[model samples]
Target chain A: MDWIAVADVVAAVLMLCGAFLVLAAGVGVARFPDLLGRMHAATKPQVLGLVLLLTGVGLRVHAWDVAGMLFLVAVFQLLTAPVAAHMVGRAGYRTGKVDTSLLALDELTPDQEAAERAAQDEADGETEQADADPR
Target chain B: MSPATPQDAGWWARWRHRMRTQWHAALWLMVVWVLLWGGVSVANVLAGTLVGFLLISVMALPSIDYRGRVRPVAALRLLGFFVRDLLVASVQVSFQALRFGWTPHGAVVRVPMRDTGDLYLTVTSVLTSLVPGTVIVEAHRITGTLYVHVLDLESSGGADAVRHHIHELEERVLRALASDDELAHAGLGPQGTAVADARAVEAMAGDVDPGAPSVTPEEDRP
Candidate 1:
């Protein structure tokens, strides 16, 4: 077996798999039930897909500099993607974008409702301040 | 500008503290800069370091508690488990989306973390979302609760499984990043009741256990 040819085949497989994952992510986002689930679809497969694609490109490039840059991209993606998802999910939940009724079992709503009740008992100015600030 | 003046003393101290907290980010940016420039030379390294420090200092991040020690063995295991779960869940979710006539059942679970610290809670939350099956809907910092939304019950193995997985994930994170003292404080080591103790303290501090069904309002607030 030609070693170079074997390496090329592996790279090709990685790229194809990466492409497939991105496609799957698109479909999942389109089909998932709620905003949070769609956010999951948007982040989950894309992370692995980006890593795999970067690895494949790095393999084919055969240069340390470009490969290092690709590695950085992967690392940054891994670090930031979930944080972005978390922010989006939190926003979606707060803005009433997430359909709570669609959820089979919701532990969050009860707490949220409870919090709202507690807020109602507070004086008017403090209630407005609580609504404005997450911290 | 001058470090010798009395006014400069506080400024120098503050700058040093900022550097101490921001050195990791600065170093990471410097490495990225050197790599992107392709091939490291003395000039390239110097320039990268200068740019990294300048950028970080100008856009300073809020300081985080950086007291944890990275346990190589536990960190490696956590990485391995994370990657395995990532692969498995991504494949399963991808296929589940592709399958016809099979609607997924989703649920939201509240997992109260053992470790009350923000760093431990953060790492666990990041890992949970990165793994594909669960997305955190809400995270209460004081109470140490993460309200996670699981994509599919069948794929995710139900609410109890999700809770177990979250607790286990938190444990792994605590092992990887938390110091021994912090671990013991979280109730993971030989002597532990920190979670309960922390919750009790928080409850006393006016933070009620809102999500826990078993804990009554009377029990938490008083």
Candidate 2:
């Protein structure tokens, strides 16, 4: 077979794999009960799937210019995906969408407890700092 | 009149200093410009550079704050580690999804960042989020703690493992990027107490087992 044919086959395989990953992510989001678990479903496969899809496109195109643009797409995705996930997860936590009992461990409780104690102390006129920050 | 001391040292020195501070950003913007246009040529390079300069000048881009020299060797090692984790975690999570009636005993475990600087905090959060099973839910800036939701938590001890794993990742990233002084901090040193901490937390959770049936009868009804 010619090199063009080989490249085409490889690209097809990559595209298929990428599509499968994306599908898996969708299934995960639908099945997961809580918001945090669903966030996991949302992020991991989607980012990797996008990378795979981009790679498949780049291989098929076989042009330096296209490769550069594809690389940029990958870079920007890498840069932004985690931050977006972090935000969504945080919002879920604040809004009480997360079921804490489902988790094996929770470390944020102690911090919240400490904050409550400090607030109690402030109410009792123990501390003079007016602008106490809990976060 | 300009300052008589360093600024007036020479035009060439000033130019070199400017390049040192600005070159990384300039190069990044140029690459972005090329990608946007989908081609590279002399005219594109000139236009990209001009636009980059104009944007940086007009927008007052933040100056680079050099934390430490990034060790390329360590960075490559971290990249390899991250890629490995990505593949492994994705497969693990996908399988978790495929399993019938599988309930994840996930938890929002808090990892301490009291020892790490601000940069380490950012890196740890981003890296953890990128990995499949965990995402940072909250970051307590003053105390330097991160609340991370970990998937597939099997037992109480798993919390410790998760925390230790995050610290291990942090150590790797810090080695790659943190300055000598930051690394020297005693709290940031070594992944020693990870196991011990897990055991301790497990002990603290005497009555409440993670993933045990804590739901009321009404809540339990599917």
Candidate 3:
């Protein structure tokens, strides 16, 4: 078989796999029962599937620079997807939007709690100290 | 005007601060522009840089603060967990959709937000809505509660399963982001408990119909 034919086959396989992953993510987006669950579907699959699809396109086109650029695009996506998710999640939390029933662990640190308790104790202690020192 | 002296230092400092912030935003924008165009052409580069600079300058004009925040590492971990869950849920959803044909025990579940911020709430809502069968029908900002519709709940599992699943996801997000106090103080935990309680009551009252379809077959088909 010619090299072009081989490349075509490889590209087809990669494209199929990429399509499958994207479809899987779409299924996830549809099937997951909550917002957090849906995010799970959208972010992960879209990132990886798009990368794979772009890679297949690059292979088919056989342009090294185009492939390199596509790789950079993937890298940028990899870097930014989580950041966007973080920003969105933080915004959601601040806005008082969350699904509490789906959570398994609390995210607060002990130091934070201790600090709040200490502040309260200090306030109470100051009140007692003032009462005792009053002439 | 008199020759500048130490009295002018405040103005200099403020100007310096603004410049610093603008430079940072501009640099980020320029990098993004270069990636977007993907060419060494001077015209493309210049145009992109100019656009980036303008956008950054406008954005920096606002006193938007992104400080005193949690680190990004924690958020990455959360993303990892979410991906894993997504894979698992995808399999389950696909199986149910193909084999069982979209008949699910559906319910309107109320989820409480961890007091992280408005950003988190919006992110969570969009994320959840993107999931195939779940949708955010209503959100109570004052109460920090989210009402979501779930698909494909096991009939025998009842509302307890729904409550448990919701709590589990919430806890996962909180732990992933180190947001316990914010969540607890925001009454997310209690709200979850309340959902569990309500589910229990509904179960006892026989109000939950097991035959409800989560998504119709037409909807599940690609």
Q: lDDT per residue, candidate 3, A11-128, as tens digits? A: 8887886787778667766775555545545665566567678878987998755766787787777656655554544455445565645543222222224445765676877643
Model 2 DockQ reads 0.56
lDDT for each residue of candidate 1 in A15-131, tens digit (9 for 90 to 100): 999999899899988987778777778899889988889888877877889888898889889889888988898888889998888888887777888777767767554545354
Scored on chain A only, each candidate's TM-score is: 0.86, 0.84, 0.73
- lDDT (Cα, tens digit) per residue for candidate 1, span B1-222: 233234446766766777876798889888888988988999888999999888877787767766778989888978988898899888887887777677777888888777458888888988998888788878888777788888886567566567767766777788788887887777666223665455334433533333555331212321
| Per-residue C-alpha lDDT of model 3 across residues B1-222, encoded as one tens digit per residue | 122223457755645565665666666666656666665578866877788666755554643333224537646755775566555554454444444234344455545554555555555665554334444555555445555555543432554444444444554455444355665653445334764455445534644343554211211111
List the candidates' TM-scores in order: 0.84, 0.80, 0.49
For model 2, state the Cα shift of residue B186 in Å.
5.2
In candidate 2, how many Å is residue A133 off? Answer: 4.8
Off by over 4 Å in 2: A116-135, B1-20, B155-157, B186-222
Winning candidate number (lDDT): 1
Candidate 2 lDDT over residue span B1-222, tens digit each: 223227447766655555556776777788799778888889888888988766655553545455666878878978988998888787778778777698877887767753665677788788888888888888776666777788777632466556656766776787788776776662444323564355335534543443554221211211
Clashes per model (N, Cα, C within 3 A): 0, 2, 45
Pairs that collide in candidate 2 are: A103-B106, A103-B107
Candidate 2, CAPRI quality class derived from DockQ: medium
The collision pairs in model 1 are: none
Runs off by more than 4 Å, candidate 1:
A124-135, B1-9, B190-222
Supply the TM-score for candidate 2.
0.80
lDDT of 2: 0.73
